[model samples]
Structure formats: structure tokens, C-alpha cells
Target: MIIATGATGTLNGATVDHLLQRVPAARLGASVRDPARARHLADRGVRVRRGSYEDPVALRRSFADAEQVLLVSSSDIGADVVAQHRTAIDAAAAVGARRILYTSTCGAGFETPYPPLAIHAATEQHLAASGVAWTALRNGFYGDLGQLLGPWQETGTIAKPADGPFSWVDRRDAAEAAAAILAGDAAFDGPVDLVPSSPVTLADFAAAASELSGRHIERVVVDDEDWVAGEMANGTPEGAARFTLSMFQATRGGHFAHADPTLVQLLGREPRSIADQLADQNIG
Candidate 1:
């Protein structure tokens, strides 16, 4: 059977749905922190089991009888994310899983201002040393940028702490691609970057927003310190705000600018671009 962690999350949940279409539901299992939350998947013939990265025994049980395990990277800020990922990897390996696939990001590496990059890099190293075959799906940056970018429709300005030429990808595309990798028999020994051939900067986003909204949207660069302070004032946790800051710093350094056509090759078509997203969303 194939097992997937973080079944309740958007990306992983979408991946599970795609997997169900590609393979038999009996061959799929979802390891979630709370089995109760995954009742829908359980009803669909998936073996929903309680599993947490913090608990190794539960993870082992959840991963039992699995030939491959899709391990979602931990998102616990201020926690030992690397160790948590290692624990999950070790548990999957112990459960006799022949192969492990991790949802890593394209920013993974040592030389980056982004803090999560180090965590992802360390996790990749641990997975490589676990004796089992591993694949790191280096996904592009994916998230809702409207909040950080402010209400351009109302203010006609997109203000952000950092301006990035990020290769933002749709989570649905990435999820489907991941399911394809898990269900197919193609061997990918190491890291594979799931990014598009093109990238869009914040300026490009402003232009698209302007066109879609039929208004002149200006790109405004806010002060770094002031941006963090404002985010905190708006009730965002200090650590979360700082993490966003580091992301901008990393982006300013061109860490997220690197684009590749691996995603297009995986899906046999061009991945949806940020412009398409703007046109479809209500924010634009």
C-alpha cells in the first residue's frame, strides 16, 4: 500500500484525491494527526490512521505495510522541524518502506537567507542516509500573496516588504504531479525541482492586477522593519512575521528566481502562471 501524511492539509489532501483516481483506494492510506478529521477519506476506502511527526511509534504503525510513503515537511515554526522530519523519515524506513518522497521546496540549500531552507536541506541529507530510496519534490513557492500585497483593488497599490521574481506554482498542479510520481514506475533517485520555465516578479503581478482590475496598480516597497512591525500590530505572531521577512530577504537575493521546466515535463503541459491566477481570482 501507499501512505501519505498530512492528509488534512490542502496540498496533501489534493494529492490523496489524485492518487485515488490513479490507483485503487485500497492501495492508499492517509496518515493524519487525527483520524476523525479524515472521515471523508476513510469513507472513500482509505485506511486513515493517526500519526504525528512528534510520535515515532504512531508513525511506525501508520506507515506499516506501506511500500512508499509521501512525507509532508513539517511547518512547526520555532520547533525542531529538521528533527521532526528526520523522525518521520526514520519511522517510514523502519516500517519497511522501500521508497520515501518528501515535499521539499526549491529554496532548500545551505546558502540562503531563508531559515526554512536550512531545515529542508538538513532533512534531505537525513533522508539520503536512511538506506531507503528517496525523492525530494522541490516545489516552487505557493501561497496566497493577496494579504501581504494589500488590497490593490481599493488602494491601487501593492505594498510589500520584499519584491520577488518568484516562480509561484499552483498547489493543485504540484499535487497531481506528486501523485503521478507515486503511482508511476519511473525512478527518480534524488531531488527534482517542480517549477515552471517562467517566473514573475512583483512588478509583473502589479501589472496583471492592473489589467484585470482595469485600474492603475502601483507597486510600493515598504520598509523592512516597519513591515514586520505592522504585521505584528495586525496580530500576526512575531515568529511568523519574521519568517515572512526572511522569505523576502531570500527572494531579494534571487533565491526563488530560479525557474525550471521539470514541472511541464512531469505534467506534459505548461503549469498555470501567476497571471492566470490573478485573472481568475476575485482579488485582481
Candidate 2:
């Protein structure tokens, strides 16, 4: 049996949906925190089990009788993310899971300015020592650039610290690649960077916005502190503002500039670019 945690979430849900097409529902299982939310999967014959990262025993029970398990990263912020991942990893190992797949970020590394990247790096280390074969799906930075440039959409001016390029990827593509790996069509051990073929800079985004919306969007470089203050003045929480600034700092440091072709190989086609994503959205 193959089990997927966070099966009700968008990413994992898409992965499970694709898996259902290739594998029988009887062989598929969803380990979600809320079984009631996943009744649709159960109605389709998938075994839905209750599991939460906070409870190791529940995780073990949810993973039982599964040959492969997909551990979708926990969404809890400010919590002990590393400990939560360790708990899930331990439970997966204890349940005799032959292999485990973890959803990680492409920017996950020691030098990343984002705190969650450290947690992901640490979780990867724990997975390495967990004895079960594992694959770290290093998903690229999400293609939700519009959310980050929220103020710019209104002001028609994008202001931020000097930034580098990012190979933003659509979550749908990431989920499909993950499903291929889970379905045994593609084999990957250790970290696999799933990113687009090219990196996109903030200037590139502004240009895309201009073209897609029929309006000129200017890109301006500002001091990091000024940007953080602006975010806070706009009613963003202090902690969230600081984290957003750190992400820009990390971007300026070229932490997210790399591009990997693994996603293309897995999908058997070129993945969508930031421009394509922006064109689809009404960012105007």
C-alpha cells in the first residue's frame, strides 16, 4: 500500500488524485488530520486514516501496512518543525515503510535566510539517518509571485532589496512530478531539485506584469529595512514582516537562482514559467 499524509491539501491532494489514476484505490491510502474532510477519497475506495504530526502514535498507525509513504511537510509555523518531521520520520521507520518521500524546498540549505529552510535541511538530515530509503522532492519556489508583489499590483511600482533570479514553479507541476515518483514511473533517491529551465528576476516579473496587464510596472530597489517598515505599515504582522524581509535578503543573496531540469525530465515536457503563470492570473 502507498500512504500520503496531508492528502486533503492542495499539493498532496493533487498528488493523490494523480496516483488514483495510475494505481488502484485499494492500494492507496490517505493519512490526513481530518478524515471527514477526505470522505471523497474514501468514497472512491481509498483508505482514509487519521494522522497528525503532533502525535507519533497516530502517525505510526496511519503508516502501517504501507510500502511507500509520502510525508507532506507540516504547515505549522513557529512550532518545532524539525521535531514534528522527526516524529513522522520515526513513525514511518517503525511502521516498516520501505521508502519515504519528503516535500522540501529547492532553496533548503544552511545559507538560506528563510528559517523554514533550516528546518527542511534538518528534516532531510533526519531522513538520511532514518534507515528507510528516501527522496527529498526539492520543489522550486512557488509561482505565487503575485502575492509577494501585492503592493506593486496596486501602486504599479515594485520595490524591494536588490534581488536575484528564482525559478518559480507551479505547484500543479510539482504535484504531478511527485505523483510520477510515487507511482514507480520515476526513481529518485536523495534530493532532486524540481525547478523550471530558467530563472526569473523581479525585473522579469515586472515586464511580464506590464505585458499581461497592459500597464507599465516599474521595478525599484529599496533598502531592506524600508521594505520591512512598509510591510508593517500596511498591517502585516511584525513577525511575518520580518520573515518577508528575510526572504528578500535570501533572494538577494542568490539563494533561489538555481534552475534544475529534473522537473522537465519527470514531466516529459517543459514546465510552465513565471511569465506563463502571471498571464493566467488577473494580477491587474
Candidate 3:
């Protein structure tokens, strides 16, 4: 059986949804923290078991008799992410899983102003050192960039600290690609980058917004402290405003610019573009 952890989350939940289409439900299992929340999946014959990274016994039970385990990266901010991943990896290996798949980020191994990259780097190192085989799905920046991009549609100006390009790829594509791999039991060892066909900078986004809105949107460079002040003045939490500033610094330092055709090759199609998402969200 193929076990997918974090089945209730958007990325992993979508993977389970797609897996139902490609493989027998009986052959799949969902390792969720709350089985009650996954009633829909349980009704569809997918095994929903309660599992928590903090509880290794529960995790082992959820992963029992599994050929592969899709270990979703823990989203517990302000927690020891590496230790949590280590617990899951140890459990999967102890349960005799042939392979362990982890959802990682492209920021791994890059020195960045952002703090999360360190966690990813440490988790990947642990995965590599584990005796069992492992694969890391190095996903691109999947979260909403509204915080980084700001409300350029309304202001017509993209203002921030120096920023660099990002190879954007939709999380949906990443999920489906992962599902395809798991269903076929494809051999993908080590970290595989899942990025878009091209990179996009804030300037590129401004141009796209202009085209979609029929107006000229300008990309403006502002001092880092001034940008933070502006964001805080606009009611952005002080902590969030500062972290967003660090992200801009990381981008400017070329942290998230990794690109590869692996994602396209996996989906056998072009990943969705920024314009497509902006249109779908009705972002004017």
C-alpha cells in the first residue's frame, strides 16, 4: 500500500484525490492527524488512520504495511521541523518502507536571508543519511505572493527591497506529478526540483498586471527599512512585515531562482503561469 501523510492538507490532500483516480483505493492509505476530518476519503475506501509526527507509534501504525510513504513536510512554525521529519523518516524506515518521499523546497542548500531554508537543508541531510531509499520533491514557492508582490493592481506600483526572479510552479501541478510518481512507483532518488518553465521577477509581474488591467504598473525599488515601515503602517503585523522584508532580501540575493524541466517532464505539460493564476483568482 502507498501511504500519504498530511492527507488533510491542500498539497497532500490533492495528491490523495488524484491518487484515487490512478490507483485502487484499497491500495492507498491516508496518514492524517484527524481521521474524522477525512471522512470523505474514508467513505471512498481509502484507509484513514490517525497519525502525528509528534507520536511515532501512531505514525508507524498509519504507515504499516506500506511500500512507500509520502511524508509531507511539517508546517509547524517555531518548532523543531528537522526533528519532526527525523521521527517520520525513522518510523517509515523501521516499518520496512521501500522508499520515503518528502515534500521539500528549492531553497535547500542555498544561503538566504530567510530562515526556513536551514530547516529544509537539515531535513534533506537526515533523509540522505537514512538507510532506506528516499526522494525529495523540491517544490517551488507555492504560497500566495500577495505579501511579496503587494497590491500592485490598486497602487500601480510594485515597491519593495531589491528582489530577484522566482521560478513559479503551481502546487496543484506538483501534487499531481507526485501522485503520478507514487501510482507508478517511479524511481526518483534524491532531490528533484519541481519548478516552472521560466522565472519571473517583480518587473515581469508588473508587466503582466499591466496587460491584464490595461494600465501601466511600475516596479519601484525602495529602501528596506522604508518598505517595512510602509507595510507596518498599512496594518501588516510587525513580525510579518519584517519577515516579508527578509524574503525580499533573500529573493534579491538569488535564493529561489532554481529552475528545472523535471516538473514539466513529470506532468507532460507546461506548468501554470502567473497570468493564469491571476486570471483564475480575478486579480485585477
- Please report, in order, the local distance difference test score of every candidate based on alpha carbons: 0.89, 0.88, 0.87
Each candidate structure's TM-score, on Cα atoms with residue i matched to residue i, is: 0.95, 0.96, 0.95
Lowest-sum lDDT 10-residue window in model 2:
142-151
TM-score of 1: 0.95
Best by lDDT: 1
Error of 3 at 188 (Å): 0.5
> Against the true structure, whose TM-score is highest?
2
Arranged by lDDT with the best first, the candidates are: 1, 2, 3
Could you tell which candidate, 1 or 2, scores higher by lDDT? 1
lDDT of 3 by residue, 49-77 (tens): 99999999999999999999999999997
lDDT of 2 by residue, 178-223 (tens): 9999897556889989989888888998898888778999999888
> Candidate 1, residues 104-179: lDDT per residue as tens digits?
9997999998888888899999999999999999998887867656777778888888667777888988998899
